[model samples]
Target: MQAEIEKLIVKFLNRTISNEEEALLEKWLANPVNEHVFHDYVQVHYAISMDCIDDLRLEQSKDRLILPEIEKVRSLDHNVKPKGFSIKPYLKYAAVLLVVGGGILLLLSKANEMENPVEVVSESEVIIAPGTDRAILTLEDGSQINLENDSIYEADGVKASRAMITYNATKGKISSEVQYNYLTIPRGGQFYVELADGTKVWLNSESQLKYPKNFILGETRKVELVYGEAYFDVSPSTEHQGSRFKVVNEDREIEVLGTKFNVKAYKDDINALTTLEEGLVRLDVDDEEFVIKPGQQVDVNKLTHEASVKYVDVASEVAWKDGVFSFKGKPLKEIMKTLSRWYDVNVVFEDKSLETVRFNGVIRKDKKLEDVLGIMKSRKINTYRIENKTIILN
Candidate 1:
């Protein structure tokens, strides 16, 4: 399967793939990570002959491709807007380079499948793949259901369909009863849910949300993210005759009228955050409360109960919902924390000082562990070891 897929990718690069092969290739690249893998093969192969692999700098001048890696970059928090970096131009430059070969493009064949341009070096050798759509749903009766199972099951009146579960909000007015359902996304897993109030949530890996089976009329539609992260597209308040929407995550509470937001409230983390992408939201943390506008994120310190509001790139907070991992100058520790949850691996720092090393890159969340690490290695922040489920940084 890997050979055929690689062959199809090669044919895609050479522009010689048949119609059927083109369909298959598109199906594979449909996953954003495969697109990274496609570029991975190209860049690694290109670096073989070029001495400027480590210090690669990409310059797009007159549709010409200039392959280079920038060695130095400052640390950016996960929510930091990449002020001066643009990846779209870089990718376009590479795409153009592969087609208009500069006389050294060796598009790999089926035989090259056995030999990867980048190597994976790990101790005890655990090949951890990326996260997928897998989660467990707990109903009000405490009955558990694995969403991954391929069966049509209805729990608490909500129907589960493969990767998505829907609650028909428009069917009629919600009853006064409040029966909560828990959607638990384990490590290396994710799931999507459509609430009875018409709000849609994309739960990231290792997250859990407790929401009422129905949003009662004339009352607030409320949900609680027990832990981890979730992106919510809330239904309009006018649809329910002025009913508001509220989210409770530990010490913080988010009240929204009709808005879209992203929340990350991990159990082990010291802070809870809510990033508003659209509309408006009011945040309540301890004794303080504030109205957050669009493009703004609120971070509430758990210990001090201090809530800080700042504008951010909404894309950074919601990138996982779009099938990509977008980082801008994020420190090693922060990045590893995000990766650990999605990849279900422990990130250990042998020398704690290395945790401050910052990286700026956009990667696909669906890529295999090694390829994802290889991308990091390409950035020169490449000291690490994989022993079973733990990734140790030296």
Candidate 2:
């Protein structure tokens, strides 16, 4: 951090930067190195002033501040002055305006895409990098294979492509006995798998799926999501000669009526949610049964074993598979939990009551956690700190 830059940041924070100085600052930020440097200043300043970040209004103000001069000029009226102003309270003010956009780091990194783009450093400690496609596959023989997006692996009849693992069902991959393999996607990781049955499964972070390398014909085709979340697109049992397709997770099970759906049964969550996108799925609770209609979600309380179904936004429910984190009036607690898994961080709330704060936004999962946090800072959504792998939210 440069001394002159530090002083200028303070002046800017105070809403006192002159037009000439503002132009100079913008030029400095245009450089990737300078962007990371300014990012540090904001991080330091934000941590010191965390108490007063504005809610929704501050976010708009910050967005206004960060917009290109052309956009600013285009949107300005003859009577109004430039929108530069102080973000109040903690860095919450500075956080959203200077740092938070929550997507800044990711966007900056996206711009560079070099072998090693810079990161927003915090007190010399490195924050957790955003997760990529990575997981571990266990064969029936207990052999473990690490999966990465840059490489491919094959075993038996399954071929792991850079994007997904696909089984060559046309080979009729017959065996003397069923050999089950398991794919476990750890926290902060995701993967895709195409079953021998031609079904497609998008495994979410912290999820696992157990299925055989080959589905024997004349037998029921099935896979179990032992725990966590996954979006399934059935290949239609009709193609498999009317072979039954079943997805099981603990006490709940779904009999795929040749359809597509998402199952979220994370071990830590109290509700097992099954949201239908197409076709039909029969939900089985113990011996009880319910059929889910398109655009409807079935919420089964794991603790109470109670079940209920209602209509929901299908896009929001399935957004993760499409590279977005979409939410509608979701509580802070729930949102953080989802983020924690994707970013591989632990969230501790200083203000317990803040957990229920409702928010609705669609953010890209590839964005650095801080940038996403910046967007939340603007919402005046909550306050917090990142200490190593722990996010202490106030």
Candidate 3:
């Protein structure tokens, strides 16, 4: 499967892939990490192809692609070239250059193609920075530790770095008592964690999760999404002696057999949303069970205890986990609610009718609050004002 996707990516860059093949490649790239993989491939393409290009075209392409002003990207010089460049040997590890300085060109290229790229606001103006890798780790003993950039914590068979915490695998060892730890992501914060059983989880801003420090062998691995949203990539049951995984909240529970899915159950939301990307999942809501397939979503109403399953674009549903906010005709109210949590600000809709105005686009989460609102203003969707930490929609 990976080989096929990589081949398709090569064809895509060579401008020879069919529409159907492009669709498949796009589906695979919908996940943000996969998108990073795609960029790495693009980096290799440039690295190899530039060696075969003429000096004049190479310099022109550099001028078009490089954007040094953006903090995330750096300028590329056309005159400089690696002394020894060979095709087969270099391609073997060309993709790994993304870690050093290869991906900046791809980032700038993406921004240039954006219909409404985030415009930089004035330096004198109030700047609300985007959320970062930050969270609160609550140990079983009721003690709490702040997790953020440049900070590290290691204890209780777990290790935490600047942005993520990982638990050591138990290796089939069973503990007599279960010890639970809580990870809470405050507003303007996000985090990632790997459980003892190898399941990876991404928590969004204003979310909390509770899970056992180590799962007992031959038992169902369980966790709770106390609030907000999370994306789960469960390790396959085959590797764990068929121990299934489960995620639960107050209103619903998702039974999984090693799948990748997303659940959004915010405190103020009217419904609990569960979207399955890969593998299968059984959702239990209000004592009713519904199995969902890939590209499907289940929305369980909190007020009426009703559940509905519908096919959806799995990419858009999980884009937040990839550092993007993707809206497909989503209403103003819904978009603002998401921004409110990530920006840690209050939102006021002065015009009641504006709440229902729909929008369609993708915005990177790394942009400042004003930069996001500016995109809406450019479209004549609406105007906004930031007073202190509150956003007023007019």
Candidate 4:
């Protein structure tokens, strides 16, 4: 009976199920036990289809799907018992059909009913791809080098790989003068950098970081986040002769006590946020001092300088550095702003009330813009249409 049902499911997925076969499948589905068998077959099929994907094909394929824990169990052996499956994290909207490329995935609406799946096609000719590793490196001499290509650039004590650049630590007595280098991550791009002091920094899209090529010994190691977001993992004070690290901007500065943290201080944003993941940080906003601990975030109003500290999920705060977009009770407006920065596109809300609609989920950054929009539609957040680089929501 399971084998017969599996054949029926294949026919259904291929959209070639005859009326009699469809009736038999629906009858078998009424048993409830048969549903699990159906899901297992579908999952195995999905996993097999997406196995061994190369980087180039994965990037070019618009249907780069992630089944969360399902990707781990991709075997064709029938004797292997499929573990329990729950689609809460990735697919809470289980009833929604996932239409990607030339494939249509129909999910059961209820235990007893199956809705006819329809392919949701985009009206646009071109799909907006996700961001990549790219940035502009501004040398101390004011010369800029684009880091978008696959070539390696090494010169003047600095070495740049495909997506990251590193500055070698000076061996002898350091110069009193500090030659500053700037790394600017434009829209739809991100980059990593290792400072001479061994501190690591991850610059997000539409962000910039300015740091010295070499740190003067016995002095306070300082770097400036001219504008935008950055995650810092500072080298310990003990590692650098007890020297403290400071990340500064025009209106705010973070004194790092040899720890890890993330800062969001976009130019157009009204509030500057600093979320600590590990260790401690002292923030100065408009001259008012505030000390932040791990698992806490300090939000300072850029205009009024009013500061508020609260406990938050540090993983969601710094998820971008890990190549995932994790949102927890985040408003649609704020989420759109984040997406705008990474995808390098503008979003228009026809209904302003939709901005306040909150959502909680995790999405990989590698997914295409349309896939995200489809998820938003599944959540009943809003109806959307993409026009060139702009996304219109109603």
Candidate 5:
């Protein structure tokens, strides 16, 4: 069977065999041992054709092809053969030529396959735009907190500064009583928070945040975000204890241990994305699990059980945490959604023509909505008439 398989491989390599025979040869070589033999044959042939055997000798002055071993078999004629171990009929001159030529071609084919170039498509326009009025945090104690509101207040005895609440757990351990708090961000705003255990969170628009008043020092620090988008910069716990931060959206749970990452899980959106920035994270959906590494993004379909990982720019995923609106060539509809949130206004498009427009630029959140709209109108996509806190797009 081995000899027959080798002959078939030779025929295929020499282009003398039909596709059926090539398929048969491939099937036989699929076995691990057979594959190794095929690879060795190709490498030996390559060494001979490239004159690498001589180079090897010059470099090491020891390694050689030992062609005499093969030549002895070739020298034997049909009648002249050793008893019990003979190459009487198979060692013809034509057979020798076939073997050598097939081996060379096989090696060349392998080299060509390895050298094949990859095709890369040019950059395309952004399909989705960033959102505004992101999410809010509500406490289990029935206290609702608007992340975009500039009001100052206190939570769990900690004061709120610039719409962010700070808790100090340095003096002692965080009590794990789970004084649940919910976070919700409306359509035109975004907010962030620093948990007691040094975990930082950035919530997108129209989202909610549910967390404890304080993290129990020795227990796992968990936070539940009902719906929306958030980026996490989790600090590693002391003595390498490693903090565990979990984001729960519906039936999906994204688990991370001392990793910097972003989770965009909106209630209306069909997919949930968990993008890793500097550490590892696990995404659990419908009892299945997926592990993601740093610099990778895992996109999970909420409807379908399908999931995939892709490379992403970490800075782009968490840019909202820096108080800047960054768009990477997103469409007009997406841009309008984001604009609506920050300006606390509703956007209505008169004609569908504006939806096709795409823009790529960064705007400060501190900038007035009119200024941003003016820039968009300069591109022929105008916004006219502000009535009842809504902008009409023409």
Candidate 6:
């Protein structure tokens, strides 16, 4: 019975099966047991299709269809469906019928269409490169500092706590002789620095970092971010006193006793995002307060005062800290924004239609503007010329 079914399947797939054989095959497949066998055959046929084994003549001329060998099984005590039944015959037959039907459909659909195929080439080439020479730092003394280079400066030093240089001065107390420094990251540029208190900071482009030259012990340890993005791996105060870490962006305040987290507060973005990588954090806005745990993020809309907590992809969120641009189905505008900061170039849209395009890929920071733009073009996005360091995208 199985051999007869196989022969019928082959003939059906070749579109040469008699009406009787087609009816028999369909009837056998209508049974649940036969359907199970038919499913296995379909899997094998799918594998062959993926391999592009579509030579109909070769398949039709084949004298033998080898079935996969099954290992010996223990005896069944009850009447059960036979194991290792082959359905390859049914799938081959189905494939042939589907292909023929599809071809017919295509022919009918294109009956009124032109025969010539049109080739499209994009005409625009506007590439948004990353930015450089951006970021400003504000100091505790109400003084603002712009950091574009790797420079070590002196600050008022107090006692050391949790490997962080504790500052001795109050927020309002600025001794004429005591120097405090703030670091600012301009749009399109990022910087890394170690404060006197041993706190490591990675400032994103167009962001700012404010800390004392040296943290004064017994005084609350705080840093202010004017804009942009940053990641902090704060050190705990000695004896587990837990240093106070606060990040102020616009009207939003993120206070943490000691935790590792990332904050993105770009001016162009609608909301400020704080993702906790480890430990805990208390997010305060206006009079509302929310506690964030590890693997959670708080999104605060600076304009609407709306806040929500959500789970996020930690690796993708912190990829910028590792000097790579990783985008997962992000629109072209958002991607261009990141490139604009990294390459320090303005992005102008020449073809507004392409702005809605989304892409999924990883771009290394070391890639040149032309190389990156070429990739976009391959995806049907064109870039125009750069006008005065501005990338015109078409």
lDDT of 4: 0.70
Clashes of each: 7, 13, 0, 0, 30, 42
Clashes of 5: 30
TM-score of every candidate: 0.71, 0.71, 0.72, 0.71, 0.59, 0.59
Which of the two candidates, 1 or 2, achieves a greater lDDT against the reference? 2
Stretches of candidate 2 above 4 Å error? 1-66, 69-126, 171-176, 378-382
Candidate 2 lDDT, 155-222, residue by residue in tens? 55678854688887654555567779999999999999988887899999999999987788867887
Candidate 4 lDDT, 1-394, residue by residue in tens: 3334544554454444688887777777665576666555454332212221211122333344533223333333535444543222213222122333322232111111112211233434558888999999999999998898786789978999769999987655578798999999999999999999889999999999999999999899999999999999899998877889999977788898699899999998998899988898999887689998788899988888899999876766787886766566677888899999999999999988778766554456776777676545532343687787898888
Question: Across residues 199-274, which tens digit of lDDT does each residue of candidate 5 receive?
Answer: 7887776767777767766566678877777888776755326556677767778877677787888775787888
lDDT of 2 at 9: 54
Deviating ranges (above 4 Å) for candidate 6: 1-179, 238-240
lDDT of 3 by residue, 183-291 (tens): 9999999999999999999999999999999998878999999999999999998888899999998868899999999999999999999998889999998779999
> Whose lDDT is higher: candidate 3's or candidate 6's?
3
Which residues of candidate 5, in runs, are more than 4 Å off? 1-140, 144-151, 154-157, 170-176, 238-240, 378-385
> Local distance difference test, per candidate?
0.68, 0.69, 0.72, 0.70, 0.57, 0.57
lDDT of 4 at 33: 77
Which sections of candidate 3 miss by over 4 Å? 1-124, 378-382
Better candidate number, 2 or 6, judged by lDDT: 2
Q: Candidate 6's residue-wise lDDT over 1-394, tens digit each?
A: 2434644544444455677777777779778778766655433322222212222222222212211110001121224445543344434434432332111100100111212111112223554444443445455556644444443334544432211223444444433343456666666677776665556788777776666665555455677777789898776664224557677778888887777789998888998999988777898988999998877899988889999999765555666766556565567788888888777787988788667666544455654665566434422453356687788887
Error of 6 at 48 (Å): 23
Instruction: Highest lDDT: give the candidate number.
Output: 3
TM-score of 4: 0.71
Quality of model 5 by C-alpha lDDT: 0.57
* lDDT, residue 3, candidate 2: 36
